[model samples]
Target chain A: MSSFEAGAAGFVLGAACGAAGAAALALANRRRLGRFLSFAAHEINTPLTAVNMTILNFISGALGPVEKTQEPWLKMLREQAERLALIVGDLRDFIHLRLRDGLSMHSESVDLTPVLEAAVESVSWGFSQAGVAVRTRVDAGLPKVLADADRLQRVFVDILYHCRKFRDSGGIDVAAEAGLDGRIRVAFAYAGVKSSARESALALDLYYPARVRKDQLLTATGLGLGVLRLFLREQGGDLSVSNQPDGRSVITADLSAAGGGR
Target chain B: MAAKILIVDDEPAIAENLQAILSAKGYETSCAFDGSEAVAKARHEKPDLILLDVMLPKMDGFDVCRLLKSDPHGAKLKILMTTGLDRMGDVEKAFQCGASDYLIKPFGSVKLLQKVEKLLSGA
Candidate 1:
């Protein structure tokens, strides 16, 4: 065969091999992703179902007339139910965004402290029940941010949930500050780490090596972080993570100031 | 007195609908939104019957039922574990957790009322 023909033949063969490898990788990724999605849905659904059932019982007076002593428990139940509902709604929206079109951003002036406080409070009871201590350093006079409230809440909840998983009894610190160029930055810092295969599998993107235990391996379905990034980007914000020198990990979210536009 | 029943599920629409149907049949109704609250209410109200759901936040229905059954004051209250968990293991777990009866989700209004009546009548 002529040298030119031989080179062309080699090129075609290489192209075919590359295409097959790509297809195989894609298939494997899809299978892994499917399992992750199913597991996440199950984990999320269990809590949601519980919340729903509890609400039903309360409304039906199946628990009896609300007594003065039972009011605090009732309030906690309601708040937790709302929190779970919001998380479920966020997950559903994340799925829809993945399967359908791009996310559309709806920006508004939102008080960052109240939103963060509510998010923290919603999950506080569960953490306390598990013996996890939480500490907050939110700046009182932090400037408002221009962002979608729902998306921001989802991001905050995701970070808080992951932090809770790692630090059982340690404290979680959440702080916000006005950054350069009219940007508002919020950070969550957590100490210690749970080195579990199951947790590694559930870790979102921007996972820090130091944040994870040395013996722990990392795996993810990539759906949660993927949706989170999409939502942030649509809102002209950014999400990032870093392992601090103090054996702690910090996840940061930056958004434009209330009056600032990107 | 006609059986006083408490339906403890979080879904507002489901709770309201169940209350309307049960109340129409002369069953006094009360509700609680979560497992912890359900336990408190059950202790206070001492309803003759409870329609509980398995999936609940914080404590969950099984734990609530267990707590209720273990309590001297709440042991007499009949609990029907009403939930979407139709699996055999789930049903078995409900029974093991002190549920007097188990009802799967999507149960018709007629069937629900019938079951409630049967439980109330000591069947």
Candidate 2:
């Protein structure tokens, strides 16, 4: 081989090696930052949790709610604690979503019915306590899907929490069935209050605020449905939302079924 | 007799705060500042519950849990891991090692007590 050809070949190889090393270092740094953010988020929760709990114990045990002097402090403390928790939670979710972006879903043969039921059960107590009704009707014979059970459940639970924000009419209906496109489709239809139409489109975006034209502006602790949609799409599915003719917001999610367990 | 708890953590503030909260709730509590110390107390004191911390000197929380679970009398010993680690794998590992429950660090007093209450009640 000619001397010029050999040198050119070495130059190309050296450049490629340098680029690879730089990429590796960048990835390591990204991972380190993600870890640090997660740690910080957890630390934030700790003190907030302590203060809130102490106040509650004091109100319930040490000092009764009848103590007028402490009532305002307790109320204010609770409100602030809740907001802190929301901020920490949103930050945590955003970090996790970013860290997990582009990663393939961990595949397992997950039954759609049980996962849906569990998600609803996890949050139904709070919903009922707050006078919000949730009715779940999953098709009895629906096939299982190859997906991550935890993320899939979070997708629905997060949606339900979102429903809690925009649902002023007091109820949400959940149903799932096989879609025509060889997928399992889950629908969440809930009564409307004052949510803007833009929300139906933009609600999936990270930290998207659901605002009204004149009066009530509602925001939730959940990061957003966009990440959940991303999770679904990565695992052979899609998510979308629309406003019904009857003035209700209906969210539809489709997941490719596994035909049967692997 | 009130149920006894061994609070295992390296952080003094977290360990002491938890001790105060659980003690106020009418339970007898003790503290160990690391994983090896936690194991030593679990064997020595044989407390009804041990609040194990994940990150510790000598050994990590998972190893401590494994040791406790494998101890002849540790079968009935209820372990509740309290840590700042929030990964799903850690939770699964805790339960796999026979943890009665897992509480994330920086949990509020009421939440902590609730888990403690549930574990003790089950005991």
The superposed Cα distance between candidate 2 and the true structure at residue A180, in angstroms, equals: 6.1
Score residue B94 of candidate 1 by CA lDDT.
87
For candidate 1, lDDT tens digit of each residue in A1-262?
Answer: 8999999999999999999999988867765665576447656665565555555455445545667777667757765665565555555555435533434456689888878887787677777766766677766677789887756876787778767665535778888888767688888888755334344333434333224555444322223444565567677787765667776766678887888844
C-alpha TM-scores of all predictions: 0.48, 0.66
Candidates, DockQ:
0.03, 0.30
Interface RMSD of 1: 11.6
| Candidate 2 per-residue C-alpha lDDT over B1-123 given as tens digits, one digit per residue, 9 for 90 to 100 | 999999998767667677877887788999998888888888999999999888777899999999989999988999998754234457777898888899865456668778888888994
Per-residue CA lDDT of model 2 for A41-140, tens digit only, reads: 8778766766655565555553233477866566566555644665575566557667534343465778888888877876665677678889999887
Q: Which stretches of candidate 2 lie over 4 Å from their true place?
A: A48-97, A100-154, A164-184, A190-222, A233-237, A255-262, B9-26, B55-58, B69-76, B82-85, B98-123
Best by lDDT: 2
Residue B56 alpha-carbon offset, candidate 1, angstroms: 25
